[model samples]
Target: METSVFTRSIESLLDEDEYRALQTHLVENPESGSIIPGSGGIRKIRWGLKGRGKRGGARVVYFWAVRRDRILMLYA
Candidate 1:
């Protein structure tokens, strides 16, 4: 299978912690791709999200598939 390269927006979205898990997920299993129909072209790819640390904060991590044709690693 051919792998798509990631976009800059998607790259910028990643924080230090987020990138760690995300990178591993991609390296180990990058074939997983979720498609979103009729999304104005912005694919809702389920890359996976993370949670806040034990320090206590609104842990709301999100995975997103930003664009298509061009590789876009989506996240929140």
Candidate 2:
């Protein structure tokens, strides 16, 4: 639920519906992504773009703040 200006700008690259879907999925499964090495607890997920498979989709980097039940979307 928290994002920086850069993150917001990066998210704008996604279609509106795709962005919403990503948000909903993250809210429901904050731990869905695997922890990224050398980056604290930041995680990354492979999000499929429209008409593209995982191999060609975007990588969404985020941090889950469990205590606050919030996800800090960092990049996409």
Predicted model with the maximum TM-score: 2
Q: Which number leads on lDDT?
A: 2
RMSD of each: 8.0, 1.8
TM-score to true structure, per model:
0.35, 0.84
Q: lDDT of all predictions, in order shown?
A: 0.42, 0.83
Model 1 TM-score is 0.35
- Encode model 1's per-residue lDDT on 1-76: one tens digit a residue: 1223343344555566776765565545444444445554333334444464433322212233333323334333
Local accuracy of candidate 2 as per-residue lDDT tens digits, 19-52 = 8898899999989999999988999999888888
Weakest ten-residue segment in model 1 by summed lDDT:
54-63
Candidate 2's C-alpha runs over 4 A off are: 2-12
Model 2 TM-score on a 0 to 1 scale: 0.84
